[model samples]
Target chain A: MVWKIQGVEGENYLESIKNFLNQLLKSKNVDAVLVPKRFPDGNNTAQVLITDPGKLDDIDPLAPVQMVNSAQIVKELTKDPVKEKIASVLRPCEVRATIELIKLKQILDARLYIIGYDCPGVYNVKDYIEKLEKSNGIGKEGFTLSYVNSFLSGKQDTIRESCQLCTHFTGNSADINIAWVGSNSSDVFIEVNSEKGQSLIEGLAGEKIGDLIERNQKINKILDERKKRQENEIDDFLGFMQRCIRCYNCREVCPLCYCKECLLKPEKMGYSSDRYLRRATKKGQIKMPVDTVLYHLTKINHMAFSCVSCGLCEQACPMDIPLGRIYNVFGRKAQALFDYEPGRSLDDELPVATFKEDELKEIEDVKE
Target chain B: MGKNSVDFEPKIIAFLCNWCAYAGADLAGTSRTQYPSNIRIIKLMCTGALDPTYVIKVLLEGADGVLIGGCHPGDCHYINGNYKARRRVAILKSSLETAGLESERVWLRWISASEGVYFAETVKEMVEHIKKLGPNPLKMEWAI
Candidate 1:
């Protein structure tokens, strides 16, 4: 229940991860190592993939921006039946989303070694790179640990809207919890939240440990403020989303989105000429790219029950739509109605997939 | 038969495939055989080319019932068009029924180039049934 830490610079975090994997590789303890890789385009961008331990040293884990949710990548990789055990380094969001994917049968495994990290915040890759490009102090000189620490101290707006409202900033269920925030120092807090996490902690023979109680409390406080900010941001975000051209980028990037055929495609479901004419007559102007509300509703009704709130959908939007908040709204409702949290645990049943006679009766009764 | 009992006459929309069923209908005409006048044939290339949505749309838009006629089993001019059509109807029927629509509103029948007698009888049987049952409730609702 207690979170723990060891002080190291952000630059050292990646190097330490490489070192940890290198040690595991030497021992031949795991089959593959999953890490973040830098994009070739000179942007402060990174993506997640399962790579061999030999490639661990080149991983850009400390890269200041996020483009895609690592959880989705992990879900794709883990979906196939595999015999080899792989160790995946996940941010808190990734771990949470991955849990939901596991429940949906989108990702399958007993062979995954999840190493969860405490996140300070991450910027949208494009926005972050643009800001970094304009700033004089930080350029291609490479972001050092001190620079990140300074940025954190100033409370600059580096985080995405999804990240600001992220309540689950600390991963609750991972084989190993690599803590960063909530403590007085920048040291990594390593605590085992589960039996496997404890085993991983015990496996680290020479690493120093520190108290994580104050750190967890600080994390909780930040989460509280972030939740309130998230609601306001969602209102502002939806105003921007009304401009969406109906591109499916948000759906494509979403990790927990496992539908084989999306209901939004015009072929499956689109406004007929009759519906179009009706809308035109009623509203005086026909909404182009029609059924926008229905598209979101159908998707939310179908999948919100298992939404992991990974926020990759927002990142993938070309329109810069705050799809994360829209998803979170429905997802929060589905979770509350069923008293089921997606990705919180592997054994939990997915709400949409599982049918119960008495479930959602209150809502059903209201309808009746 | 009881005095109050009306004989069941099935309402049928025979969608004749241009190659087979339509040819059969034409043959029925040329042969000078007396057949039911109730059938209204809509010519199509192959039974497999049917879209279930189109079928549902028409059914909901006032078609009392539908009868999709295709080439018998392996006799389809477009290889497996009939086979595929069969599968689509099977899925559509169950889905529509689940959505509270009557599955009987849609019907699939495979009649080859030689099944004129069968086609005529099928149409007669359908008209008699529909006349007794009245118009489809769904069609009435959509109209309103």
Candidate 2:
């Protein structure tokens, strides 16, 4: 069911979201709320856990910048059971990554309420800061609203590439989704996607709205453009990966890469001066930062089946490699072969972790 | 290292599951079912334990091809190990394609203990395929 949340006549749409979250806190619907808030310096936004209703003033869930996939934050918060209920407001990508982490046994989701929203893709941190600086007097909220408008109108192209190609922009997996795809500026649609969402908003009064035909249409249009873009970029992996310096920033930011001791680490890779010299001797010429290609290949082997394509890895790359696009291409193919969609639901088993007797029969059929 | 010359012999690294493929290879040796001398076999406890990194390491270390031999479906001594191995190999092959590597260089097949002749023929076919494919482009001269 869809319900409308009223906005102050001329106030920003983000204000309406803040009002809803503030209600959740003030009315004791939830003990606390986890959402992104702008720093006092007006240069950054990060997730903050707020218990006080008054602290909702600076909450900007729609800010067009994501420093990290908040799914990791959710994992940190719920790794152990908490006495008080926490409502985590996350972007769709983060929500999906959180679901994957839950399946990987990194999170205990017993008392957590996942709140997701329509993600209008975000810009890279450096690019976002530059845009913020250029919009001199406009506050972060104002600048973000205008940026989102331009993006929805197809005039903005500065979003990270993974987001550009993302077909799953809506938070269908969240319990409660703050839907704005087809809704007007004066009000936002609150969708109760699951039983938890239904129970959470039981007493809140709002106008009931039916199926959003316009939203579905808009989503299809975006998907077509993204599929075309993906086809154009898929084969350029070798060129993009050539400049990697083996920094492992991509691995560090990935929410699904939840290994306690990563295989890519120096100790795990068994790196030594003698090993490097020997590799150099054998190769005749070796790149200074060795195993750049191997590091990526190993990562794909490990987690491509679970990759949510949030693109945090792309944002974290120092070499500007499109690691997100590369992983997504491989992930899409691998997941398709097994007819699996990671993060679609908790019930779907990871492809690598399970198998069927009659499945993948072609692997045994040797064509002479 | 004139890899393109007719005298060049492709080096193939084969990881055989001990329960089925390794026994089959041994049977081939004892039965004198002659196969090419290009393959160097490593016996693994189970194909499910085969890490994609080993396949990658050998290729990067100058092996022209990788051959993974496991038990037939439902014939694995450890229940469904071969099934899991098949899935891993599939994912690894797709990843290799994405990395601009020749995925065809990696082959997966089932070789039962009783099928020693099939095992010899499979090796012969793999060696010929690798010879035609030439040396792995990522192969380096020094040991990895």
Candidate 3:
């Protein structure tokens, strides 16, 4: 059953969500709440753990700005079992990455209540800060609700490229999904997807809403447009990779690149001075800080299946390389070979971690 | 197959599993089976141990081609190393191809210990293919 939280008088979309989170905290159900709050820098936003109901005032979990994927944050929170229950409010992509992390055994035993929302795509941090300054006089919530309404109406185009093509913006894997797309940013809807989500909304002030036909149609429209625009148009990989200085910032920002002992590290790659000189001599010449392409290829081989296509890698690249689009193209193709969608479910096996005895025979000994 | 790139000799890195492919190469050597002197063989305990990083390293470091030989399906000495290798190679090749590189430069072939003639023929076929493709494009370029 879908429940609708009617907006209180004079409350915008952001205020409605804040009030909802405040009630959930006072429900005596969850122990602590993790949410994205504006940093002291007055520009960036990051996840903040709140234990008191009073601390929910300055929070804007529905803000259209994501500097980092919260999957890494969730993994850190649940690394050791929580003392009690903790509720994490996250975006759709963060929820996807969280599910993948749980499957990869990165998250330990803990009571994690996942609160996901229909993400109205995010801006690169720079753009978000600039937008904040442009609307500086208005309060944060006032600016955010207008932003959400605009995004829901399909007027903005400055969202990150990955967000434009994201088919999972509806929080498909979360236990509880907060939807605002078809509600016109006025009536916030809470969708309980699991048993834990039911408890979070227990005895709350809301009416049981019926079929979400309008909401479903709007979501389907977005999905259709993104699907049509999902083709890989990269023509020359060599030319595209010309500006890489081999800094590996893409790997550092990727949520799925969770290996503690990465083989791509310079020490692990074993590129001694002698080996570099010999390789340059052997090839008549070689890239000085070599293996930029190799690093990408190996990373793709290792974590492409787990990639959520969140575009944090592209945001992190100092060279402004479009690493997000490249991974999205290749990662989806790799997953499609086995008919696997990473982070879709906890039951589905990772393609790289498991294999069938009699399957994928065509790949071996074949020229193709 | 005498079609040639004249003086251009392609460098091939052959990661041959010891139980099957390496033994097959040894058998080819003892049986007077002649193959092109293009491949530099590195023996591994199993194809499962063959990380894609090595293949990528040699390719980026300017090896013309890579040939990973292992046991056929249901014939793996470690029970299923070849199967895993097959999947890994499939992913690696797709990643390479999507990035606009020639996935054909890397080949995954099954060569059993008893298939000594097959091993020599596979090497001959690979050498010919590489010769036709000429030197690896990454060979002359210094900025990878």
Candidate maximizing DockQ = 3
- Candidate 1 vs candidate 3: the TM-score winner is 3
Q: For each candidate, give the interface RMSD after superposing the true interface residues on Cα.
A: 13.9, 3.5, 1.9
Candidate number of the best TM-score: 2
Error of 3 at A362 (Å): 3.6
The chain A TM-scores for the candidates, taken one by one, are 0.82, 0.94, 0.94
Off by over 4 Å in 1: A1-11, A39-42, A48-54, A135-158, A183-186, A198-203, A206-211, A232-242, A270-285, A355-361, A364-368, B1-144
Scanning candidate 2 chain A in windows of ten residues, the lowest lDDT window is A4-13
lDDT by residue for model 2 (A1-368), tens = 87775432236568778888877776676898999999998888999999999898888888889999999999889977779988999999998898898888998887788899988889888988988999988777789889778767875467888888888888888889988776655456788888888767766666778878887887788878887777422675655667888888888899999999887898988889999888777777777677766788888899999889999998998888877788888888888888988788878988988988777666554344
Residue range B1-144, candidate 3, lDDT tens digits: 133688778889999999999999999999999999999999999998999999987887778899999997889999988888888998988888887877789998989999999999999999888888878887667877
TM-score of chain B of 1: 0.83
Task: For every candidate, give the share of true A-B contacts it also has.
Answer: 0.00, 0.52, 0.75
- Give me the displacement of residue A368 in model 3, in angstroms: 8.3
What TM-score does candidate 1 get on C-alpha atoms? 0.63
Higher DockQ: candidate 1 or 2? 2
Q: For each candidate, what TM-score against the reference?
A: 0.63, 0.94, 0.93
How well is each residue in B33-134 modelled by candidate 2, as lDDT tens digits? Answer: 999999999999899999998898787677888999999888999998999999999899878877777788889999999989999999988887777777
User: Scoring only chain A, what TM-score does candidate 1 earn?
Assistant: 0.82
Q: Pick out the ten consecutive residues of candidate 1 chain A with the lowest summed lDDT.
A: A359-368
- Which of the CAPRI classes, incorrect, acceptable, medium or high, describes model 2? medium
